[model samples]
Target: MPTTINPLRYPGAKRQLVPYISKLLTNNNLAGSTFIEPYAGSAVVGLELLQKGLIKKLVLVEKDVLIYCFWKCVFYHTEDLCKKIEDTLINVDTWIAMKPLRDIINPNDWDILELGFAGLFFNRTNFSGILRANPIGGIKQASKYKIDCRFNKPILISLIKRLSHLRDKVEINWDDAISFMNKAKKDFIREQCFVYFDPPYFGKGEKLYRHFYLSSDHRVLANFVRQNKHFDWLISYDDDPYICGLYSGIGAKYCPFYLDYTVSSGKRSKGKELLISNLPLPPVDLSMTSSQY
Candidate 1:
């Protein structure tokens, strides 16, 4: 599969796991199955699968309003959205000026495409790509600015062009993950389907992401997935004992996936991730790999 340039810097994106996921699906004869991504953060994995022609159909569901808008624009209005992002200057002054717009804009107003633009701007310029809201409900300013790493026109153009190819084959939605999963299971009963869950990690996600899943929310998700054992499913989470116990007790297969990368603290770190699957996966290899991008 060819590499895709992702403009959005989402936390805990599954770019590194794409190869392993592709291998698993191929070995299991599920390359041409219908693919569902319930918590589509960057929508990177689904896009990759679609680009590689690994999936017959693709469904993406994102709960965050801004992210949903951004993806909607990408799929439906690619050229216009790319032009808007390209023309906008990336500087501290521009970033500061966007604060009020972020504060005033109502996400419910469907006619406004600026929500998508604001999401693109802040996600590209914010520190570590962390989108935090202030106490007053506006976007919080980054503590430090690194002008050299700001968004560039070439990168945005490349990403937009790549996403435009899968517009017809992909369906993007704004809904809760569980709701999408429930509907999808019923809709694709005859066809082979694969569902990949990349929900908010139990502990770390609550602190980093603006919208996060609580422990109770995780439990609810676990129960739902456990009950529905018809579809091929895999969930990604941090390597925490609580999460491991939750899935292991339910008889799901759990394995470790590792990646080495730099963290927000400017230090190199290695993460041991867990993959819980309803079906058995291939043998686990502990070797760490860098992301293809």
Candidate 2:
């Protein structure tokens, strides 16, 4: 299966794990179920499922205001926003102007379309797609880098095409992950819904993201999942001993997944990953290369 390219750059995105996730869903006969993603950073996993017709409905909840606003624009107003992005040129001056806007535009007060435009520009130009903030809560200035592949017109257009089709079938929200999960659990039948969690990994997300999850948060999530044993669910996290110990012997299977990729400087690196699923999963090839999509 071809991987779907994410519309924006995100930290800890699950782009490479989509194929294995799809295989698991297919094996479990839950391909056509309603899918819910609570910690939807880039929403790559949910989008892939929707694109492949594996899920009949997609519910994506993101806590980050910038990401939530960007997805709102993509799903609600694709043409106008994409055209705006297409005509604009990315440079140092544009970046300078957008930095302040990113700091000031509260997702609650500003128009989502405008926020979307700002997010598009900021994400495309930022270093490594890492959304960082200064000590006083202003967006950090992006390092000067050559602009070429990041702002490709063809890729932007393709993203718009994929997102536009989801306007009716998708629901995007800005909410706390735990609260959203609790509410969502009540809305659908346990047998007809599949939840995929890509929460902040232990010891890693705190440094990279502002909305980092702490150890207590992880425990809360585990307790909730344990209590709700009837729901079909899967979670992805970095391979941490603490994380591994939390979900062990909980009627779940821990699968060690791997990804190999070259860094921006062309240095090769590999990482161990984990997928905790309540349903039976097919044997995964831990040696699979990372997706180029």
Candidate 3:
């Protein structure tokens, strides 16, 4: 919740692609259009764009109940969330106590908002902000970096408060991306909206993240984006052959680029990623080497 940039830490946070998104929005004359994000994992990109005044409004859709409820608590229960952060102890003992609160298997968003807090706790404390990954410095707590190394309460609360003020410009939804796109096709006017698909990675993504798409669902999403060329849309994924053929075979415009990945050890690694979209990309960026669909 620090940096006025991203309020949440995601293992796959697309902080690097913010520039690319901004350029696309400017070049396509869709600067003020309503931006839609189907997979709201950490919401790194959308919130960055909205906060920077690049987009007029934002719509965040996620099927995961815990993530959705965490966002709900962030925006709707702003004051209480702030107070909770202020009062909570940031230690291994507290981390152990909050484990069951955000179980992806049996996620409970309600129950006095402990689940919501648990979601935030895991996100900030876990390795690389991966919700399901092991706690930072391992459970043994001997890696020099303590559990609360990333949990800056005052800054987190400050960012959350500022973000909550933008509640009027943001809309959060708990639904699959495909369902949201279907409704969007009917409800949106085609010209005023831009959809960004940062679906789970097509390769190790399934194993790396809590929520992911099977092959069939990926195809369904690609089909929708390809068929709806009238609506400016962009999709990205870890560069994989199956994904290449799935979208490129269908004649969608493609741009192969790279986004950077930061491992839990603070080491930076590079990987080639693909950006498939109906809009003309500004240019391929190879920095921060690595999102969607």
Candidate 4:
């Protein structure tokens, strides 16, 4: 097994919910199955499964071009990637001090996004490491505040150990998720596959998060889910009227989940997220059971 790989380091990642998610899986009897993440933002949950040996393989699909390429590099060229970052920085001061160099790298380039080699050195030396910039089209702040990532020795060791196992089990896909799942059903006929969908939430301000995922895409995805009769699945999304309407009659066991709104106001809102599962989940009482350790 690989060392503990922290996914919370990524912006907009759901690392804080690892305990809840893992408990959800444990309740569902999902250990050792092939876990599929259609929108694998930062792969926090998927990576956790890998570390715990809870899943046999992680089939990840990310539409974001830069993020997808970055993971590909991590899986294929882990050591070279680390070396490039290391060779670029000597005592970590130069790594964190240079702002011009960080700005120079094009956002389009996967290398820039895969900053673990280059960016991680600087990210680690700062505050909370949120990598936050003002929302697009929003007012430009006088100065940028960063929650710098601390690339400490323990973290480096953990990353290296995990990379070895991750390089082999992680599979990447550039294709549209609906089509990919359709094809996967054919190949993995008898194999158990659990699909996790974390599509974009509606009505969130554009600058609040990445706007790459289009609203129309949800309809297409929901259509695919309604018609496709393949494997068991789980989907998480804002509990909006439109989303509820879409999942209606989809034959999923719907459950409500409260979303932690720590990003914007650092206050928990009355907002809710819906979890739709095609598989039947056991009646595990959250308060009474000590399932989530």
Best by lDDT: 3
Q: Please report the candidate that would top TM-score against the real structure.
A: 3
User: lDDT for model 1, on a 0 to 1 scale?
Assistant: 0.74
Q: Which regions of candidate 2 deviate over 4 angstroms?
A: 1-3, 11-13, 104-106, 133-144, 147-149, 261-268, 286-293
- TM-score for all models, in order of appearance: 0.88, 0.87, 0.90, 0.71
Q: Where in model 3 is the C-alpha error above 4 Å?
A: 1-4, 104-109, 264-266, 285-293
Candidate 1 at 179: error in angstroms?
A: 2.1
| lDDT (Cα, tens digit) per residue for candidate 1, span 1-293 | 22445667665646777777888899888999989899987877878888788898888898877777788888888888888877877666676776665553345764446777777777766655666632111234344435326576677777777888878888988889998778767776778989999999776786667679888888878888888868888898889987876776777888877666545563557767889897787766544544322
Look at candidate 4 and give me any clashing residue pairs: 123-148, 123-149, 124-149, 124-150, 127-148, 128-147, 129-147, 129-148
User: Candidate 2 on 195-287: residue-level lDDT in tens?
Assistant: 998888687677666588899898888888888866699998889988888897788888887766433343556667888889886777643
Candidate 4 structure quality by residue, lDDT tens digits, 1-293: 22236522433335444565667677778778888988765677788777778888999886544445556656776676556545554343453355444443343553543443434443343223323332222232223432222344445545654665676788987655776877777776688777787776665634333334466777888887888777667787777888888778867787775544434453333356677778764432322111000
Q: What is the lDDT of residue 288 in candidate 3?
A: 52
lDDT of 3 by residue, 2-57 (tens): 34455577655477788888998999898999999999878888888998899999
Better of 1 and 4 by TM-score: 1
- Candidate 1 Cα outliers beyond 4 Å, as residue runs: 1-3, 100-107, 110-112, 133-148, 285-293
Worst 10 residues of 3 by lDDT: 284-293
**What TM value does model 4 have?**
0.71
